[model samples]
Target: MTKEQIIFLHIPKTAGTTLREIVYAQYAVDRITPIYRDERFMDMETFSQLPPEKKDAADIFIGHFAYGFHQHLSGNRPYKYATMLRHPIARGLSLYNHLKNLQFAGSEISFSELLKNKGSQFRNNQSRYIAGWGTQKMLETAIQNIEKDFLFVGITERFNESLLLASHDLGWQLKPYKRRNVTSTMWATNYADQLRNDKESMQELQKLNTIDMQLYEYANKRFSQQIASHFPNAVEKLLHFENRLHQAA
Candidate 1:
């Protein structure tokens, strides 16, 4: 068994729910250490105080926390970190729609207004989560951290490819599983479609997430390089993986 436990830093709306299910298949229920709710963050104080036995037994710790969670772990077990990134604008829109669905205090406001609102917490969220800061310049820090500390930084747009690469690299047996915590409603769909044509909204969205956009593009570049280095037969292997899923169906 792989001794390196995974500390998954799950950014919001980055296909993280689907990735969690895939990781779940590789470990027994007892091996997972759930840290926080969807909107809440991982509590480092509580995590560091986990009982020795429970801490020692954990093989994976998944949560919607910022990076540096590995430092909070209690045991001596070696660990690795992983995270996912998405197209910053798409992720930002998805997050907005989700909050709107929940009737967030300002749900009635326009998307542009939400971006302009200084209180909005979702802007440049992918970079913030990875770098553990909300500054515009932390984009380079996020990329440095990923390349230095993370086992892999997966991209949501290329989720299947990411999964297959991890499976091949780590000997993980990824059985077919359902996507969880999906966010598709008619209003959400309609708004997303209309938002594409609204140049002003789109421009504001891009401007607010400049750091996140750059971070995402860098991840895409690295993902392609990773595929070339680690799985040159990637296309054929991906097709075979899909064939198995169809056969199972």
Candidate 2:
């Protein structure tokens, strides 16, 4: 069997940090290329420029890049793509908290003010990231890409099931790992209550992330169908995996 090359499109704030730990446990560190960190490396173009030996040596390509990175591979190695999706409203809030906590761009503004001031990139970010643009056609393209290109698209809300399904398909022994990169602000801690108390803000957030909301709904439906069709024993397996993880902990 030709070994499969896995491309993990690690969308920001989607439990990607924990997923990376699981991946690192399964694959040798040198075989995994962390492309998200270096802004100099423009996904496919930079990957294409790598020497053939380096290209063949890497087993996984992971980062915040979009869907088309696999097209840049030089060899005949078959690749499978995987990603996790989050509810757009929650993701947006998490992103805002992350930036605020880190004192990054837009950290000084209130969430409402930030929404008003930030670019479209901050709005329907998941859709923009997946489709590589923020057009209606691009949204359709993103859905098509998920349908055709991805081997497994997981939901961040269903982290354990997602991990178990990916491990089963990829033949990896991925145990549950510690979560990382969590938002650490008091506001973030009470985000759910804040949203509950501020109906207008929640509505505004939904309105702003219309594209992402649609995309997330689509991905979520497909994720459920995938579990039902491909991983019938997923619940049992997930339970077992959790039990094992707890025992280890």
Candidate 3:
């Protein structure tokens, strides 16, 4: 197993759940950190204060934590951060739909109310996680952090390619995965189509995610560059991986 501690900053609703399961197969149970699910987040400050030996036991830390969360860990081993970004508007809509589902039945969130909630996680959330916090210069900081500190930044839209690319980058033995945590069910609302039909609602969602949009665009560009520079036969390998997944299915 690699000595480097891999920190997965799982931005909500970005196919992180599916990727998380794939990664779990790559490590021993004890080597992986406890992953808090749904809404109860791990107390970062409490976890950060754990003794070095205690913290050093795990080789991989996985969570819905922010980008710089690795800073909280003991400085005993090398750290490599990774995350997945999605098209900001789509991601936001997904989050909105998810929260609406969580509420008491019939208490649906109107598009206007979702847009106006200043504390909504869907609002510039990808940038907040990437920059590790909100700030005036968040985009610049997030870009620099990605280039300088992160081992990989995967795109949720291009999940298969991103997984293969990340496996290659991070020394992982590849696995075929059936996608999990999908909203491919009768209950999940088709909010993207709804947003497209309503101009004002769409514009409001767009406005809320401007920084996240920029960050996602940059991640996509970097993803292309990284693949070209690192995986010359990526297309063939990706095709082969897809064939395996198809066969497995």
Best candidate per TM-score, number? 3
Give candidate 1 misplaced runs (Cα > 4 Å).
38-45, 105-107, 116-120, 134-136, 185-189
TM-score of 2: 0.85
TM-score of each: 0.87, 0.85, 0.91
Q: How much does each candidate deviate from the true structure in C-alpha RMSD? A: 2.8, 3.2, 2.2
lDDT score of residue 142 within candidate 2: 83
The sequence of per-residue lDDT tens digits that candidate 2 reaches over residues 1-249 is 127788888888898987888888888888888785567434655667887788878888888877777767766677877788899878877776665555454344666776565646467788776776435666788888876777777899988878766765667775758777766443434344455467787787778888888999898887788778777887787789889889887
lDDT of candidate model 2 versus the reference: 0.75
**Model 3: residues with Cα > 4 Å off, grouped in runs:** 35-42, 116-119, 184-188
Candidate lDDT scores, in order, read 0.76, 0.75, 0.79
Comparing 1 and 2 by TM-score, which wins? 1
